[model samples]
Target: MQPLDAMSVFEKVSVADIPARSARRSKTTPLREAISALLPEEAFYVPYFDQETGEGFKPSTVAQVVGRMSKDSADYRYSVRSEASKNGCYIICNPKPSNG
Candidate 1:
């Protein structure tokens, strides 16, 4: 008796025979997801923005990033921006900072 090759057996399998796994939508909102993804921990602040001056600043770790992001106004459009540095983060202001 001849043994069947694994590759040949695999090729014979029909796509319909395989069970499909359903992808469930995430319960967290996009805002939360982005925030969490950008700031995975709480060790340090991400320096998202200056609470008083409303200027963006860069922080090193994910925690710093999240901490900084947490200080931002939850309802503000600027909070949606996520980047590694202050230059990349969003700053809601008129006549944006000259250095930025």
Candidate 2:
């Protein structure tokens, strides 16, 4: 048997030959607005990172937003679990029940 040619296995098509589709709108809500709407008993997941790392942890925006909000409020209570794949963590926010 002869050796297989890698390029010969696949067919190449021109970019212009591809079908055109309409642009889809983004479904993303503003971060602050979304965070502000969280129910007291609701738990949300956010990615986290370590500031001090000769290891391999980068800063996460979700983590920062949650942290800032927690610092700004006395009633905010949260639990975090290390879930997901490598270098990822989940911040589960469990805020205290409001008086009202």
Top candidate on lDDT is 2
C-alpha RMSD of each candidate structure in angstroms: 14.1, 14.9
Per residue, candidate 1 scores C-alpha lDDT tens digits across 1-100 of 5565633443568889988988766422333445544422222123444678765443333334334555563432223234555444432311212343
Go through the candidates in order and give each one's C-alpha lDDT: 0.41, 0.57
Whole-model alpha-carbon lDDT for candidate 2: 0.57
User: lDDT per residue, candidate 2, 1-100, as tens digits?
Assistant: 5567643577789999989987754322344455566666665444444466433233355556567777776776544456667456554557667888
The candidate 2 region of ten consecutive residues with least summed lDDT is 25-34
Off by over 4 Å in 1: 1-11, 24-100
Off by over 4 Å in 2: 1-29, 45-59, 79-82, 85-91, 96-100
TM values, all candidates: 0.20, 0.39
